[model samples]
Structures are given as C-alpha cells and as structure tokens.
Target: MKIALNGRPLTDQTKAAIQALLGELARRGAEVQINDAYGQTLQEWGVMHPFTSLYTSRADLFDADFVFSIGGDGTLLETVTHVGERRLPIVGVNTGRLGFLATIKPEEIAQTLDWLENGNYSLDERVLLHVENDRDVFEGTNFGLNDFVVTKTDRSSMIVVHTWLDGEFLNSYWADGLVISTPTGSTGYCLSVGGPVVLPRTNNFIIAPISPHNLNVRPIVVNDSSRIEVRVESRSKNCLISLDSRSKVVDDSIRFTVRKEKFGAQLVKVKGDTFLETLRSKLNWGLDIRN
Candidate 1:
C-alpha cells in the first residue's frame, strides 16, 4: 500500500515526527512517500530510505492508498486541496492546537497506524464547497472542504455584502466579513464568528456574519442544495475571498456564488472514534462546572 505524508514546515518537532513515522512504515514493509515540501524537511533531518519516494506533482498522489496529514488542521486543509477530486481517504495527525479536523493525537500515532494496516477504520465522507466569482480572479473554479469566506482585509473598510438564497434575496450585511462554512468547518472560524457547530455528516451550510452592524442578523443555516450568492461592495480598492486557506484579490464589483460540490472528500477515521466524542474531549463540551 502507498501512503503519502504531508505537513507544515517551521517546526522541529514535526520534522522529528515525520522521520519516526517514515522509519516505522519501512519496518512494516509499507511503501512511503512525502509531499515535496515535507520531503525537503525529511532530507534536512538526514533520513533516507529506499522505499520512500518524493512527490513532484499532484499526479504523484493519484495512486496513493492513503494520505496522512501530519500537522494541524491547516495542514490537513492544504492536503485536501492537493487531493482534489481523487477522493483518496486522509488521516489527520494533529501536531498543533485545536485539532478539530486533525483528530488523531500524536501519542496515539502507532495505534492509529496499526488500525489502518488491519482495516479497522471507517471512511467518513465530508461535504465540499464550490466557489466562483464574477471577476476573473480564479482561472476556473475552486473547491473547499472547509469553507468559503469573504472578508475585509486588514486595511480595508467594513464592506456591504448583499446575499441571495436560491434566487431569493436574503439580506444585505454590513460587517467586517461573512463566512459560508461546511459542516466540517462549522467548528472552525465559523464558531469563532458565532456560527453554530454542525455534525460532520449534516447536509447543511451556514452563513455567519462577522461583526455585523445590526444585532438581529444572526447566522443562518440552509440546506446544502441552496444556491447562495454574495455581492461585495467596498469602499476600498478590493475585497478578500478565501476558499479554505487560498485567497484571491478581486475588485469591488465582484459577486460570489457558493454551493455544495457534487462529490465530497473521504476522511479515514479509526475504529471506535466518533465526531461528538472528539468534540467532548477536545472542546470539553459537557465538562462539569467548576471554579
């Protein structure tokens, strides 16, 4: 079986962890490969194995049986973009704080990997978003497993966003920004911006305003099939549109339409792990009150 490892740079502990994982895979006789960005980090650690290959392009991962995301949720998001529509299952190993998406703890790496080899796992399918802009910022179309956000940049003033749902006008939001998050991303920036947490398998989407001018404009949830449109009108030169972590600059005259993609991303979950279990453990969702 082939497994591709991807992670973030600028951290020494992550570098060591990758080396140890690569060594373990070799001992188990499983073929291993590293994303080019991470391969450089491995070489810097002075670890080399004949069974390992370095990925040079997206084509290198087409045949991978599994993709191991070895960092925080951000790195996992990055790995998703690289996976595109290949639908390869991914296992996120958390090496950063607030690992909602990167659910596997670092200490349980060996056990989790063992489950993978023994087929003791579940493949959870998560929804993805399709984002398009009237302006020619993106070459074609883009997809995000996490979310699509339209925000005012650091120097930009608060913008007015006119929204429509399934061809019906929703409301005009005057705020710092707005977020259209997937069920997978509801716990992320969406939560920070007052959006409710949604189950990973829920067929819903959320429109959460970021610091809205009116207190009555609460975050709204809608069916995934709804076609949503957002028109940005800012006093500044441009506005910021982000699909997951990738962003593009667009003129104020641009309009964004976001909806669910035809397919979803498949994530590898080890046996006996549940999404709510992670929530209670990670977020202390039901912890007792104490001073």
Candidate 2:
C-alpha cells in the first residue's frame, strides 16, 4: 500500500505518533510518500529514510491508495480538494480542536490503522458548492467543501444583496453579508448564524444572513439544485467574497451565482463511524460533565 502524507508542523506527541505509524507501515511493506511541503518538514526532523516521492500537484495524489492528513480538519479539507474525482480516501490525524472532519484521535492511531489495514471502513460522499462570479469580480473560479460567503468589510454601511432562486426573486437582504452552504458546511458558518445542522447526505442548501438589518429577515433553506443568484449592493467600493478560506475584494456591482457542483467529494471514513457520531463528539451533544 502507498500513503500520501501532508499537513502542518507536527508537535512532539504527533511526531512520535507519526513515527510509530510509519514504522508499522514499513513493517507491512507499505511505501511512505510525503507531500512537497511536508517532505521538507520531515527533513528538518532529521529522518534519514528517503521518501518515495515529493508531490506538489494533484496528479501525484492519484497514485496513492490513501492520503494521510496530519494536522486538523482544515488539513483534511485541503487534502480532499487534491483528490478531485479520483475518490481517494482520506485518513486524518487530529491535532486541533473541534475536529469534525478529522475525527481520529492520536491515542487511537494504532487501532485505527489496524482496522484500516484490515479493510474495515466505509465512505461518505459530501457535496461541494460551485461558485460562478459572472462579472469576474473575484479570482479564478474556486470550489468549496464548506460554504461561500459574501460579506461587507470594514465599511460602515450594511450591504444589500438581491437574492433569487430558480429565476424567481426571493428577497433583497440588508445585512453585513450572506452565506450559501452545502449540507456539509451547514455545521460551520451557517450554524453560527442560526442555521440548522443539516444532515451530511441531505439534498439541501442553506441560505443564512449575517446580521441582517431587519429582525424579520431570517435564514432560509432551499433545494441544492436550485440556482441562487446574489447581487451585492453596498455603499463601499470594496466588499469581500470568500470561497472556503480563499477570498478577494469585489465591486458591489458584481453578481454571484451558486449551486451544487456536478461532482461531489468522496470522503473516506473509518468503519462504523457515522456523521451523527461526529456531531455528538464535536458538539459535545448529550454530554453532562458539569457538577
């Protein structure tokens, strides 16, 4: 088996865990390949073993049987983008807080690996959002595993967003910003703005307003297949549009249309781990530790 490794700098504990994992893989005669950025970090650690190869492009990711993300859920999200339609499985080693995507714990690494090696796992395909800025207001078109946001910057005036669904005018929103999210992203920024926690497999789209000026205006949920168009009308010359973590300045005159992409991201889940389990663990649901 071949595994592709990518992540942020590992801590001492994480480094030890990685070393142990690599040793076990080596014992099983599996090859270890590091991503270009991570390969450099490994050299700084003074490891003498040679990496199978250093990968900087998505094409290199297709060769691996699995991609191991060593940081947090963010790293796993970044890694998932590299797989594209290849259906490459992701194995995340959580090193950060609130790891909804990176559910595997450092202490459970060995047991998890044992199960993975023994072919004990299932997959969950998460939908992705496609953003089209028809006016070329932002940079090259990008994809988001989370949500896309159009928000007012430091400007004092609130922005007005004219929204439409399937060619039917919805409502003009007066707020700081707006977010259109997939079911996978509903738990993120959407949740912060009073949006519901949509099931991962639900065919739904969540439209939530950010600090709407009117108390009567609230978040709305629509079909994922619905074509939603938004035009920003802000007093300021500059507003912000973000796809996941990537953002750029855009003129208020520009319009954005968002919908479900033709393809979705294939996420590799460990055997028997369900989305509800992740929500319960990450959100501390049903936990009563206070005394």
Best by lDDT: 1
| CA shift of 35, model 1, Å | 1.1
Model 1 spans with C-alpha error above 4 angstroms: 49-51, 134-141, 154-156, 289-291
Q: Write the per-residue lDDT of candidate 1 for residues 1-291, one digit (tens) a residue.
A: 688888877376665566677777777777777788777765676766444577865677647888999888999998887787788899998888888888887777779878998899999999999986655465543888888999887654689889999999999999998999999999888999999999987799999999998999999999999999999878885788888888877777877889898878888889657898889988887788861
Model 2 TM-score is 0.91
Per-residue CA lDDT of model 2 for 231-253, tens digit only, reads: 98877866899887678888877
- In terms of TM-score, which candidate is strongest? 1
lDDT of each: 0.84, 0.81
Candidate 2, lDDT over the whole model: 0.81
Q: List the residue pairs that clash in candidate 1.
A: none
Q: What's the residue-level lDDT of 110 in candidate 2?
A: 77
